[model samples]
Every structure is written in structure tokens, then in C-alpha cells.
Target: MLDFINRVLGRESGGSKEIAKERLRLVLVHDRASVSPQLLQALKTDLIQVISKYMDIDEKAMEVTLDSNERQVALVASIPVKSMKRATRTPAVSI
Candidate 1:
């Protein structure tokens, strides 16, 4: 009832609690997945390799974790990029 009243009055009710609930939900889902730790680590390694093929990234600082809401699951990866290869511009050919 209080939440409904707050909503009607255009006030946010307990945003931090909601955020914490969502984060807890994600951690629970990740913890509950059936894959072995070794396999998950392998997957994370593969992710780093694939991403590093395109950009110079902070490999030592990368982190990969799983997350899920009620209906969807995701492999969340935090990769810090140190630098990116710039594309060289070709001289424009005038017709």
C-alpha cells in the first residue's frame, strides 16, 4: 500500500533495496548453474582470447561472471581496454 501511494505521488520507494534484491538474484543464479568450475574458467579464458584478438585489453584485470533475472541468463564480462588499433585512412581518389 505504501509503495502504491509513493508511486501515485511520483516518488521512488526504496530504490536501494530494489537494487540489492536484483544483485542478489543475479548472484544466486550464477551460483546455481550446473557447469563445473573448470569448464566455466575455460569459457572465461576463451572469452579473453577472442576479445583480445581485436583489441589491446587489460588481461590481468578482466573479470567474468554470470547473471540472471527471472527469465534470462547472461555471462557478464568486464574487460578493460588499454588501447585500440586505429584504422588508417586511405587517400581519397578524386574522379
Candidate 2:
């Protein structure tokens, strides 16, 4: 609603510029990695699901990104966990 008005006014509609910039970054990263944006999204979704099984996460706040330097590439995940589950202990079996 408000975004429509901002667009009408020839303004960057409600932080859409930021969204566009981030999307562009994602595209660049994926292009360099030879992966499609859809593949990146699929990986992010899977990461969220797998991580959520062990923690209470703020799913909306999570971010997964690929970055590259002159020599190497990195896959980074920023997951905001509300609470992390403790590891369950098991007794050692005697021989």
C-alpha cells in the first residue's frame, strides 16, 4: 500500500532499493559460483529446515550467502537462533 505511493512519487519504494541491491549481489555471487539464484534459494531453505531441528530460530532474520576473494570462495550462514538445544548424553557401553 505505502510502497505503491512511494513508487508513484518516483522514490525507491519502501527499502526496495536495498532489496534490489542485495538481489544484485546474490546474482553476482551465483554467477561467479556457476550456480543459479533458484539453486541458492533452495539451499538456503534446506539449511533453515535442518538447523531449525536443533534450535529455535528467527527464520525471517536468517541469511545465507556466497562470497569470493581473489583465491577462495566462502559459503556463509547467519542464523539467529532463539535457543539452542543441549546435546543429549549417552552412557558408554562396557566391553
**Could you tell me every candidate's TM-score relative to the true structure?**
0.59, 0.58
List lDDT for all candidates, in order: 0.80, 0.80
lDDT, model 2, position 18: 90
Task: Give the alpha carbon lDDT tens digit for every residue of 29-71 in model 2.
Answer: 7687897768879998998888876787998898887876567
lDDT, candidate 1, residue 57?
92
- Which consecutive 10 residues in model 2 have the weakest lDDT in total? 84-93
lDDT of 1 by residue, 1-95 (tens): 99999999999878899889888886688678865668778988898888776678997898877877667888788989999746354547899
